[model samples]
Target chain A: MPDTIAPRSADAATPPTPRMSGVGRVLVAVYGILALAATGRTAVQIIERYDEAPVAFTLSGLSALVYIVATISLVAPGRVWYRVAWIAISFELIGVLVIGTITLVAPDLLGAGTGNPFGRTSTVWTLFGAGYLFIPLVLPILGLWWLAKHRPAPETTGASATSTAVTPGASGAAA
Target chain B: MIAWFAGVQIAVAVVGALLAIILGLLGRKPSDLTMGPLILVELLLIVQVVISIVAPLVGNEPSGSLLEYWVYLISAALLPIAGGFWALIERSRWSTVVIGVVCLAVAIMVYRMTQIWFVQGL
Candidate 1:
């Protein structure tokens, strides 16, 4: 609620702009961790055996990119970043659902990607993120909720360039 | 990957978690008192990294992909410090919770490293 711990000096012409704070901090932290995990896993998978499962590995790489973008957008302020965050989070949700369903219903489809006799390939959203305690599945939903709560006010609905004079901390109070 | 190391990791995580709970109950932020256990865990993790790196070079063939082990070790070693610095910056009670989460994560990672060492082979 409060912009920060200390009281603002009278000369403070602009209100403190809230990029990330309170519950947002926890959200960003989780996103940051997931981004790192996905990045690391995809990097290792691609480097070690890219040819073994190109499709699966590429999906993993895409998932990693989504996580990275979501984390950055969440950390940035203004209406533009807000929209970017929504898009990234929505894409992530769709990816998990599509990948999870395809992996389950049609293992044969991705079997070529695995190349193993059993047709087993693990992506970030495989089995609804069983490997990561379902965080991958649950995170985007929470992100959406947070984004809805933090949507920009009507006056700041313009693009990033036009909202430079807007006070973010004042608007964040609505969140 | 050693038994004692894994045990210590779990113990440190448990200690950090309990400390964080105490701070929550007392309505406290991440002050010096609450951060002590996290600092201790960070120290232990650094020690583990040093030993893991040096032990292998000295012909102690650990049973796992050395690359994976190193990544896990380095990440584990950094987790608490990163959390600590964030807590200092945020100065909120949730910061204490962040430290707790990092400690738990480190514990899980260490366990995974141990499993990698045993199951994956050197």
Candidate 2:
């Protein structure tokens, strides 16, 4: 039996959800790092100066939480977990967009001496996440793409088909 | 915040990154050293934590609040621990690369913490 990440073919064979692929593994690790970075920054900002900008700081904290939840769900092996991860990743996309827009439009709402208000210079979502070249902005979207690629469907036998398909006598190479 | 122990830990981070690259290039992992880097870092961090706690006791740091400095120190420790966790679980060449990058990041964060500790800028 092969691991759950074989490439797709159409001979009535189905593959299990990919655990870690060439790209997915790197993506997961990147998300994990971002989760920690954002979480720490949010925590420090809130603790050091919650009085400064409650709205932005609280949103920062919220992004941190979503990133953490997405990281865990994406990495763990389960159909349900992957779906759950997609939801969190979707939230990240929306969060970055919403937060990114508000900061750009209403800079004064951040107040002076807010310690890098948008945190775009430091966060996973500043300048459309340009500090990370919007990779942080794009990560969750890719995660959803990866998740959607392998999600079980009405026709596919899912992982069970993959194990049998991996036999030496059968076509064994992953796509 | 504790300079001596933190300095030694920076050296460890550099060494850890080097080790990871070497192992990864060989298509191997320092399973032996997988836990080694974290252990050394944690030990040094514990020592640093102790100093941050006792800084007020020594009176040299009376002007600086022990609480905030301690928070920074604690955060410094968590970085490598989380990196090590991901490194061990993945068991791939990229894991080694991730470890190397994390060590580099740790060195920078440690240096920043030391600067904050001494300057104690309000």
Number of the predicted model whose TM-score against the real structure is largest: 1
lDDT of 1 by residue, A63-116 (tens): 999999999999987667888999999999898788777766775466453322
Clashing pairs in 2: A7-A175, A120-A126, A130-A133
Q: Model 2, range A1-175, lDDT digits (tens) per residue?
A: 1333343333214334454654466567667767766677667767776776676667778888998899888777665676788789998888778666655666545544232333312344544565444666788778778776655333344566677766656654643
Name the 10 consecutive residues with the lowest summed lDDT in model 2 chain A. A113-122
Name the lDDT value of residue A113 in candidate 1: 35
Fnat, one value per model: 0.10, 0.13
Cα TM-score per model: 0.79, 0.65
lDDT of 2 by residue, B1-122 (tens): 45687788889977876786566556665365755775676677778777777765776462333444555566667766876787677677766666666665566556656655665444
Q: What are the per-residue Cα lDDT tens digits for candidate 1 across B6-77?
A: 788778887786787567456578987768888988888888877787777787666756766676777778
The clash count for each model shown is 4, 3
